[model samples]
Target: MIERFYLKEFLTFKEADLEFHPGLVVFTGPSGSGKSILMRSILASVGLDSVEAQICESSVTWMIDEERYGLQNESLNTFRHVKKEKTRYFINNQSTSKSSMESISSTYLRHLSLKDYSDFDPSAILKIIDERISARSPQYAGILENHRVKFAEFKILSDQLRSIEEKEKHLSELKEFALYEIGKIDAIKPTVGEDEELNLIKKQLSKKEKIETVIAQAQGIFSFESHVSSALGMLEVDSAFFDDAMNELHSIIESSLERMEELEEVSVESVLDRIEQISELKRRYGSVEEALEYRKQKALELESYETMEHSKSDLIKQISAIKAILETSAKELSLKRHAILGETLEKLNGYLGMLYLREATLNLEPCELNASGEDKAVLGLAGTKLDKLSSGEFNRLRLALLALGVESMNGGGGVLMLDEIDANLSGEESMSVAKVLRHLSSRYQIFVISHQPQLTSMGQQHFLIYKDDESRVRELDDAERIDEIARIISGDSVSEEARGFARDLFERARGL
Candidate 1:
């Protein structure tokens, strides 16, 4: 619940601080006295509206999950928004992102003015019906869950079957391509590292003459080895060490000459052709190893194409089986929904009857399987689409749904901000709406703007928005409330008769 709201430089409100209480809080004034501006500023403070204001702040006292908002345990929290050249949002004085502020504020605040469409959503309608069923019949709830799961599986299989059928039209062409690619790779039989081996051989063959010259020079050194041994044998200082050194040098020279001889047999053209073979495969498939992997994949694809007729038949069978299951489950779920539709509509009419509105109609019909279900629900008011209803009628119908659905809620209800919900309503109808709202206030914290004296009398906390040179807002004292309601009853001038009626209305509301 919002405990306080403050606005600065926001339209007609230069600076205003309004304290609020739970239950129905109403703001009443003449038409041009900034009632809507105050509501917009409060919405902006909670990240629900974009308003040009220097500052908009709200102090809320509700049991919130501190961890979810990344805060320590606290009973009261302040949300502040300031708009300069760019708007900045803050929670507990710590700057945060706009989305984060929206996410947290949405849990506690709901602004349902003229344009909210959530009440008319088909999926939302189905969810409300399911919540009712779940509360009364847990077994039916499990059945609905099962049906939803099976329908999801059916959608997946149906999509896969459609894709495979599209591919099946070109099966023969796909088979031929896969086989051609596999055969092309197999023809080369390319091996990893074969390119490097061939390059090494090609390098040796390219420098064959230089290698031969080096081997000849090394052979000359071996000739000097025998002369060195003879001199060392005569000196007798270390003839064994000198002979060992000369033998090792001669061994290395002989190995070089042998290698040079081997190069004579190597054909540079053959080595170049082998390297080109592997390089061509690399150009097509990134690397030799990748080419081999591609060949393996295409081989499997070719095998699948060979037996595609049987696979296609199996897929058709699977789709038919899933479709049959989906249809049966969808019908059962539809029946259960329709079973509750009459009760829901009857209860809705009770609320609408009090509000002096026409009854709403529920239409459940078949649709192709979707993520939501195979049933499409359409809610109509007085034989007309919900979107075509008048704003007053639409808002009252939404309130009716809220009345029926609040019991199914899992957590504390959110704050409801209604902009002149009693506009265009008759005196009795306005009182009925006030009565329903006051009842709903047990679950939701309601803030409403009202032009009707009956609705204003129902407020637990009332504020009068008035304009002198500039617009301002102040909590109405008991005597002030009577004057305000009397003004609302009899226009700009308050008459003695209107005051008497206003007093009686306040007295009656207080008794209720």
Candidate 2:
């Protein structure tokens, strides 16, 4: 609930500061007196709307969850909005994004106007039903949560089954493709580094003829070695050394000649063809090693495809088991909701009757299980859909829903702002709406703009928005309230009868 709110330098209103209370806080003034603008300014401070203003601030108090909002151990938070060229929002005097401010504000503030569809959202309707159900039995809370969990699991499994079933329709074709890929690579019979080895062999074969010619010339040098040794013997000095040197030369030349013989056996064409084969494999699969790896991968894929039927059978069994659990949980949830749903409808209709709507048939019907639950709620008023009702009926209906949820709301409740909620309503209808709001005030901090004297007179805190030369807001004293209520009753000119009536209304409200 907002403890206080202030607007400064906004349109029509130069400055206004108002303290709020727990009950219905009504802002009453003539039309075009900047009441809506003031409410908008307050909304802007909470990041709910945009306003051209110098400053807007609101002080709120609620139980703080440190884990959720990243807030410290404090219950009171101050939100401020400053609009210049760009609007800036802050929480607790720390600079923050507007979205963050809005998120935190949403917990304790529900600014429901007449046209809000949030109360009719599927999730919200389900929440109301669940809240009322839980109020009746705590066990249903765990049951509902478990059912929701199972529903999520079922959805995931269903999606997975659909995907696998679709893929399995082409299982035979996929398996055959995997086999064909493996076969293409297996026929190559690639080995790691085979291309490099073949290239080296090809280089050696290319140099084979030149190597043989060099070997023949080297053997001729060995042939001259005998003559050199004979000449050395005539000198009679180091002929043994010359023979040793000649033996070394002969060994080196014989090794070279043997290598040439080895090259003669190697076919250059065969080496080239082998290199080309390895090169082709490299081009296709990146490398000889990678080609072998691909073959292994495809073999594994083919194995998985071969075993797909067994895997699918296992999955089907798991899905069937979970489906049983889902069916039981959904049915149990549906039963519990149906059991409490009648009570909820009765309470809603009770509120509707209080709000002066007599002929409304509201019911919750079981539907196929989805995320929310196995039921859908429908509201019909006098044989027409609730949405097709007049703005007056719709707003009153929304108020009725709010009154039903007040005791069941989980948190410390929220601030509810109603703009001209009693404008088109009859006097009795306006009083009924005010009474309902007064009841809701036990749980929600209500801010209502009204031209109705009954609603204005019922305010726990009443402020008057007026435009003299400029717009201004002031809390109405007891006597001041009489004048204001009288003004609202008679409009622009307060007569003696209007004053008497306004006094009686205030006196009657106080007596209540």
Candidate 3:
């Protein structure tokens, strides 16, 4: 239940704050007095869409233990358009997200009316019955959760299987392409340093003849004896005076002669053999670096292909196992749904009678199991389907569903918001709806927007929404509420007959 609501800079409402209490609370006013606008603001602050107006600031406070009926924690604020495009949400003064606020708020507050009756949807019908029937059983919640999990898993696997099957026709071709590319890289047999080695060999081969010629010229220069012969001839002629110099010069020439002979013995065959080896390497490997890279790639491909078959087999097995589990879970869920059909039908029948339909029947039919469950609800009046019923009849059927929801809720009931739901109802029918709402209020916090005297009179806390000068405001006061109801009855002229009717309705409702 919303303990309080604060609005600022909202449509037709510059600033307004209202406190809500348990039991029926009514908002009454003349048409176009900003009643619906105020309601819309409250809904927007709680994460619902606004009517072409952004919520500048809004806050809602709820009771803590009130979570069982759907209120989990207390106090939520939504601040928007403060300084940027982002909107800020808070729960208990702690900053949160809009999604979180929406999820938590939905637990405690359920906005329902003739325009939106999701509780009456066929998919929700079974869950409602189960919540009531299994209220005392701890195992019931666990069972339902288990069923939900199993159903979710089943859906995921089914989707995956379908996707895989769709792609299966191309699997063989894809595998073949992968294999061919992997094989081509594997046969290259490259090595890391092979490119550098091959390049060095190629260079040597290109300069081989030049290198050999240079070596031969240096050997020939050293082998020549003419310079030594000339130096010996000069020493012999000056032997007496230059004996020491001549002997030293002769020793040097003899040592030079010995080195020249040794150099001439060096083999050219060894150099040619080294060049040939390098040429052979370059031809075979293309380049040493490329060879090494090729080897690494080939190794990786071999490892991948070695395990491909096993991995594919495992995936297939997993898909099959999940399918089996899903089938079993879906079967169990279907059975539970079938079992609850009778109770669901009986409750709808009761509400129909209260709704002024003397001969109404709710029929249950089996449907294929989906995520929400399998039983479908079909309403009939004197054996005719509800779609064939008039608009008024449709609204009444919706009322019946609301009544059923009220009966089924556990512990502290949910907060219900009704927006002119009794608009087309007759005086007696309006009274009946009001009575049901009043009874529901014992376990819930209810806020109603109504023009009907029956509903307005039954409000335990009545708030009148009206325009003052140029602004709209809501105030809680008995005199104001009476005047508002009187206006609704007489249409801007509070005649004696309208006042009397309002007084009588209030008296009768107070007795309830």
Candidate 4:
């Protein structure tokens, strides 16, 4: 709801600041009194319309879509349009583009008489139709809810089944690839510690000849071992120490000679080949152990692949069962809606007839099963699309729809702006329109311009726009409202009888 609006430097209006409330807010004055200008400025303040006003701003009780637009929610957000070098829009003091501001405001504000077809959209129609169905059939909501749940489960399982089928088209190739990877690793037949031992043998083989020559030359030291002991015995000095040293030298020579004989049996070519194979495994899988682990994993996957058909069969059976039940429930829900659509259409046409318009047809065509079931509701206004209708006819149709929704709307729906909704309407027709608007005002905050007394009397908040030196507006007292309505009824010179009639209508509207 617009809490207040301020306008400055617009044509024929120097400055105006007006406080507003919910319910049917009406503006009334003689022709060319800038009533439309005031309305456009109000719309510009919210980015619903363009205006050249230097400053147009409105404070509203609308919560900004903080997740999308990144603006904080306030008790009241101020929407402003300023024209300095160029037009700029601001919401809650945050700079925003005109399109962005309009998108945010459109969620809470609707210009009923304009070319916006949001109310006639298929999703909106289906929602209202379902609401009407819910009113008549107590079990319809349960059926619809069941259909939605099953349909969701059905879609999910269907997607999974489809993916499995697609993979099955290449299942043979996949299995072969897994087998080939396992075979490639098994061919190496590598062991973890085998490579390290082979590397030691390769190092020894690389120095085999040189190490053999050194060991043969060192054998001479062992040959002189007995001579050294003899010399120590003759000198009678540490003959036992000499014996122990000779024994240690003899053990070292024997061990070195034995290791050299072992290396002579090691094939260097075979050691090199084994080392290359282990290096390849290391390069591919980081280690021989990792390669073995990967082979184990692939074998497990192949085993699972061999058993997938059983799982696929199980899923198919489950999906078939759910699909059958979901289809039945969706069909039943559609039947319930079709059964109640007449009552919904009758209420809509009744409202339309009162507004002096023709009947509207609601087409419930079949579509794919969805969360909304298997129905798509489209409202046709005498074969003319809503966006193609004239302003007056279009607005009347909108009123009928809004009236139909009053029963289902839980609370305040949004703000509605209409321009001269009662224009050129007969007294009876205008009164009917006013009554419908009054009914909707419980759910909507309506702003309307009126040249007729019937709607003028219906305003919960009435303001008189009159130009003296400049276009000015002020809230009217009861007596002043009567005068204004009487002026609307009797033209430039208000008659006594007109004043009496206006007072009665004003009082009657209050009673309604």
In terms of TM-score, the best-performing candidate is 1
Local distance difference test, candidate 2:
0.82
Off by over 4 Å in 1: 1-21, 30-32, 57-80, 90-96, 99-110, 114-118, 226-262, 303-328, 369-374, 383-385, 407-410, 466-480, 490-496
Model 3: how far residue 150 lies from native, Å: 3.5
Summarize candidate 1's per-residue lDDT along 1-512 as a digit string, tens digits: 89999899987779999888888999998889999999888888988888999999998875546677675535678888988889998878888777877888887888888568987898877778878877888887787777778777777767777777787899888988998998889889998888787788788888888888877776777667768877877887678877787778778777877877887787778778878888999999999999999999999988877776787788788878877876777777778888988897788789888888888787787777765557787777887777788888888888888877775666658799999898888999899899889878877899999999999999989998889888999998889999989998898788999999999999898998
The candidate with the higher TM-score, 2 or 3, is: 2
lDDT-better candidate, 2 vs 3? 2
Candidate 4 lDDT, tens digit per residue, 1-512? 99999999999999999999889999998788899999999989999899999999999998888999888878999999999999999988999999988998988988866666777888788888887767666577788887888888989988988988987899999899999999989899888787788888888899989988888888778777778778878888978776787779788878888988887788889889989989998899998899999999999989877888987999899999997897788788778778878988898899999888878899899988788777899899886767778878878887888889887775688899998888888899899999999989999999999999999999999999999989999999999999999988998798999999999999998898
Candidate 3 vs. true structure, TM-score: 0.64
Ranked by TM-score, the better of candidates 1 and 2 is 1
Best by lDDT: 4
Q: Cα deviation in Å at residue 317, candidate 3? A: 8.1
What would the per-residue lDDT of candidate 2 be over residues 1-512, giving only the tens digit for each residue?
A: 88989899987989999888788898987778899999998888888888889999988885556676675634667888988888887777777888877877777777767477777765677788888878878998888787778777877877877877887899888878888888777776777777777887787777877877777776777667778888888887778777788788878877877777787787778777777778888899898888888888888888877776787787788778877877787777778777877787888888888889865565677777776666787666776675677888888888888888886866557788888888888899999998899888888888989989999888888998889988999888899999999998898788999999999999898776
Per-candidate local distance difference test: 0.84, 0.82, 0.65, 0.88
TM-scores of all candidate predictions against the true structure: 0.81, 0.75, 0.64, 0.69
Q: Can you rank all candidates by TM-score, best first?
A: 1, 2, 4, 3
Residue pairs with backbone atoms closer than 3 Å in model 4 (clashes): none
- Candidate 2: the clashing residue pairs are none
In order of listing, the candidates' clash counts read 0, 0, 13, 0
2 against 4, candidate with superior TM-score: 2
